[model samples]
Target: MTADPTTGISSFDPQRALALAADTFQNEAEALLAIRAGLDASFADVVRLMLSCRGRVVVMGMGKSGHVGRKIAATLASTGTPAMFVHPGEASHGDLGMVTLQDVVMAISNSGESDELNVIVPVLKRLNVPLVAMTGRAGSTLARHADHVLLCAVEREACPLNLAPTTSTTAQMAMGDALAVALLDARGFHEQDFARSHPGGALGRKLLMHVRDLMRSGDDLPRVAPDARFLQMLHEMSAKGLGFTAVVDAEDRVQGIFTDGDLRRLIERGTDLRAFHAGDVMHRQPRCVRDDVLAVEAAAVMEQHRVTSVLVVDAQGRLVGAINSNDLMRAKVI
Candidate 1:
């Protein structure tokens, strides 16, 4: 073990650090559970007020609570609720203009006595905006002016010094998450709605991606007539580079599929490739999906059936497109 020059001892102890971390985690977990049990009808009141507000939810806080408030606002905004964070100190210095009578204000302070926040309470009150307080003390100055109060008081702090904002901040963060999620559920926000807010994210790619967006259509789709010779199916599969070709009927309806694996198995058996037709060697009842189906669903279908590719069929069960595992990989859905 390396010695610490500063402490004149071992640089670090893994067991000691892990044990302490576990203690901190347990303390924070207990704090969140306590807050959960303390939640009452007032939590619903906060949601109802936010829902009715015509303007955005303006979250205000000081110190560590401010960091949590910013995340809370982001979560709310992304989950269908329009929200933004305004530092309490900035609000006093003209950022208060961001808060309108149409908006709702949520002030957060562990002790609920932040001077910067108290300075603007009257202005918010005079503007006739609805006020909500997330604080540990119910009777704090900020809470008294608030139309609704969410108790975020923790029994103890996780900090060894018992003075740091560890457990209290954790409780505040958990409460904010709970409130935002409740609002999300009440609004019936679906994954698609969430995807729109996060269009550049992986979730958006998974939820909003459709088979039509990634499928190989027209000439890109490998297709051959059912009566085509087995050698001709191989030519189509090789030309399209999809490892498979759909055997279609006269009206473009899919009859079956011929893949590279089928050719390998046929060659292994010394089958007469020259005489065999595509219909005779193709796998009947190939898995097919609609163009509008989610790409994630297509991936699920592939995984479930252990196939590398699937045919995309139209409304009348006619083959219109094809997609392989490579397409999903490019789209980052798989």
Candidate 2:
């Protein structure tokens, strides 16, 4: 029973706090499991309704449900389902114009009777938009007016008083995720599609960025003719600072590659470095990728071959560019 030095308030019991947190986890996990078990065809019905909707899925809620609704809308939109969150209060004040006959309305309420949300139900119906309700109460006003109902009921909240939106909100969040997963699968959404929607995100950079988007080309690419002196190849490699140089023929077709590692191996074998030509010292059949290959694919090539740099070539097998691990790291694609 220690008193706080700052506020002179009694310090909380750590064991009691931990116990409460554990109970919250258990309660939320159980709620999600229950919802998973109780899911019926209504879930599919909602997915089908939204899939058929030509306009966006307009999500609405109040308080904590509103917060959950916003996240649901974001997940849906990023996962190939066009969606937006509309505040119920704002909807009554001309924002309702956003809802059209082609849109689908998803109203979220734990009790399924949020007055603000319920107020706009009639207007949504009048607009002839499909209404999908996510609620804990199947018989409540919001559910009753909905074209399809997604039951998010829970036995009790993790709050000691069973009043706070704890386990209930968890259930709602899980249900929303489930909906997003199902909808994405139904739409045949791919990683490229998700990347298109989130170009600034890490996954987008990895999936959408191609070798041509980041590779060094032209004068920036370190290259030398097969007959060039070893010193000239070293100078090109040093000038480019890519730790490697490609050995090409007069037609700019890649014949081999000389890297710092090859230099070290040659020196270790006591090879005559001064008398060597680019073709003589370079390693034949160097690992390379097409300019159009995904940067992540290039990373994979580097990983599989245990190399830090990869040569980029065109359809005619001509040297077009060079990409290294550093380039991928700079682009955050590795």
Candidate 3:
């Protein structure tokens, strides 16, 4: 147990350090399991009340719990439920007016005795708002006044000092996630609904944005008749800046595609470019997609085949549009 004089600290033992880490993880896992088990009839009641709320759910807490409350409110809002976070301290300074009688109040306090939160309890009750409490102590004032209680009780703090909120906060966060998922499932929230809530996110782009929105249509689409010469197709590809040109038959059906890759191969093989038509040099039955498909899905197809561009066709296999990696990049679907 002697300290190392050179380092001026106790000698570190790797085995002991690893053991402590394992114990901490085990304790947190057990605490979260306890919180999960606690989700019973009371949890159902909370969901029922929240679903029935006509106004937004006002989530209020203080200190570390407030940070967790903000995340919970965001999760609730993004998933079918309308919610917003209100600081308990701010609520006392006339911010309490934000909570309406039709709204539901979700209060978070590990001790359930946070003085700032206690100040607004009576006002919330006077407003006749439903109070849902998330805390460790059921007998605590906040829990006593709550219409429903979510028990986030834990065995002990993960902090070595036992003063910091660690395991308890983790339990609370997991419980909040469970609540959001339950509500989302109950409301039958779909990907399209989620896209509406998160239009700026990747999933939103995948679900809401179509290939037509990102494809180069009309004159911008690099296309030429099958009878066009190789040089003509190359010129079209260069002018459109798509690195490829669609070779179409008289019926406007996509007959083939000639890209910069084909040009390189032709040059390597010393083919007479002047005498070859687009039909001779182009790749027949090139990868094609529908304009109605998601731009994200188009990107996936391009990446899967290691190609830079794809031809967009209609149900009749007629060339209607074109897209490249640049198009996906511009649309932020990449």
Candidate 4:
């Protein structure tokens, strides 16, 4: 049975339901492809203009385009492009004063004719500031007034009524992302640079946090000498609370490591704990990292080697500290 068109109450029509969802995706995809084709040397022009701006790249739009512009501005700012969004309506009222000859403006309008934006374009021109217009209408007033043009036309809206700004907005968003990424690459923005803009997030922790920042050092480290009894290593592991203990030589160079897994395996083998020493029951080449390594990289080492804990070392390969899954979790880099 066919589903109700008005309320969209389906009567279990699998083919129709799938087609409905697929059509929206297909339309949006086609719109994005059209934008990709529409991009030309003008894209390079805008990028060069933006790169030359000593001040911020100011973004402006109206309605749905405004929302997209704001996101675009934010993306640009975070990716090292130095950008901000100014509401076109507000610009006409007073915000137009924010525009300087040092700045570049990116204005978006599907129709290429927002009055609020139009009112401010003349002021920008008078200030000799470059304006790049993103619009579907090539012959639009906004396009005619702009110093450069970026076309964002769509074949049709994804909306069944062909009225809502669905496909057009998607195209705009994709274009903004593309532009931001292009600028990011041009500026040679690195992971550390990205982390600087997002210091409070997991990515920041991953990029900026070091192994020493989260490792158990000094007395906090679970350590036992190679000649130490298995019972002594167990006591050290428990006292340190890292579920494992490293076996080191007299010079404090790591010899091996004994973990909870080692204990379990030894117990399953019916070996007498009292009979074994640290050197006899420990993993000689345990997964280990340096104190100065990125904590995220340490976590990756642990994961790739399938270990719960890693011994932290120094330049001389001597045991200095230790870290485990718990430390990574505490640092939010897991």
| Candidate 4 Cα misplacement greater than 4 A, ranges | 1-23, 190-192, 199-205, 226-232, 249-251, 261-285, 330-332
lDDT of each: 0.92, 0.92, 0.90, 0.90
RMSD vs true structure, all candidates: 3.0, 2.3, 3.0, 3.8
What TM-score quantifies how close candidate 2 is to the native fold? 0.92
Q: Write the per-residue lDDT of candidate 1 for residues 212-268, one digit (tens) a residue.
A: 999999999999998998778888899999899999999999999988898889889
**Candidate 4 C-alpha lDDT tens digits along 1-334:** 6678988886787887689789999999988887897789999988888888899999999999999999999999999998999999998888888887789999999999899889888889888989999888899999999999989999889888899999998888988998898899999999999999998898899999999989889989888898898788889989988888989999999899888888999899998889889999899888889999999989899889888888999999999998889889988998
Q: 1-334 in candidate 3: lDDT tens per residue?
A: 3689998899888887888799889989988887776678999989988888999989998999999999999999999999999999988988888988889999999999999988888888888899999999999999998888898988789887788898888888888898899899999999999999999998898789998888889999899998897778888988998888999988889999998888998899987899988888889989999988989889999999999889999889899999889888877888
Estimated TM-score for each candidate: 0.88, 0.92, 0.86, 0.82
- What lDDT tens digits, residue by residue, belong to model 2 across residues 1-334? 6899999999989898899999999989988888899989989988888888898999999999999999999999999999999999998999998887788999999999899999988887887788999999999999899999999999999999999999999998999999999999999999999999999899999889999999999899999998899899999989999899999998999999999998999889998888989988889999999998899999999999999999999999999999989999999996
Judging by TM-score, tell me the better candidate of 1 and 4: 1
Please give the lDDT score for candidate 2.
0.92
TM-score of 4: 0.82
CA lDDT of 54 in candidate 1?
A: 93
For lDDT, the strongest prediction is 2
- Checking candidate 2 for backbone clashes, the offending pairs are none
Top candidate when judged by TM-score against the true structure: 2
